[model samples]
Target: MDLRFRDPQTRIGNLADEPILVVCPRCSRRATVTPERLTCAGCALVRVRSAPNYSVWNGPVDPFFREPLWLRADCCGGHTLWAFHERHLDLLERFIAAKLRERGLGDDPGLTLVARLPAWITAAKHRDEVLRTIAKLRATLS
Candidate 1:
């Protein structure tokens, strides 16, 4: 099947609404993080967000609590890749897998996450390696 995509106009902020999978600081196991709370299954630790205000996060860390994300892998010449959650990772997988990707047809295309993706993430030469890294990250969930 042809991998074609018409940009969805999704922003990274919109993705944070989904659960953020973070490495539990207490148990070194997977933890679930939301805008309001963080809960770890292995450690039975629960913490509420003390400071709700957030600066934009675009790295391998949770936005609200600033904890390292659980689903992370090394790729693309030692660059660490990560995702907030399954949905976030799925979005990245689909975006990277697409053979023909179009920019958003919105007021400002630059506002979309796809437009803001790093050059290494979007470059054709790195496609296979990046997809492999994404697969490695996805494997962490299961």
Candidate 2:
């Protein structure tokens, strides 16, 4: 069977709505995704692919439309974890932090969501979409 992957940039409908997070595991360097390229600060290595070299999505919908997809690539001395944000991690973190503060649960600084995160997030499968809906509802109510 022939397999093909879509160009990473092409799938993202709007750059404004989506921001990419790049993390290098080797040197523990992280940065926002750049439109032109991604250069690791710790090792000073750069991404050569014109389009983000992300792995193929196991689902039907394009990865850009799904929850943040973490793609790891060999970089520096080890690997770089690229988190393509459909909803942006910063916003999610803020939302969580705000809710935590409101409930007096204390802030979970540097909260990391790893495997099985999809199940815990609102609407499970559609995390970003559900989060957006919740935010909209909160705005409407407030």
The TM-score leader among the candidates is 1
What C-alpha lDDT values do all the predictions have?
0.86, 0.36
lDDT of 2 at 70: 34
TM-score of 2: 0.31
lDDT of 1: 0.86
Per-model TM values vs. the true structure: 0.93, 0.31
Best by lDDT: 1
Residues 77-121 of candidate 2 have per-residue lDDT tens digits of 232223244343333334333322222222431232321123344
Candidate 1 lDDT for residue 27: 93
Off by over 4 Å in 2: 1-19, 50-87, 93-119, 123-142
Residue pairs in collision within model 1: none
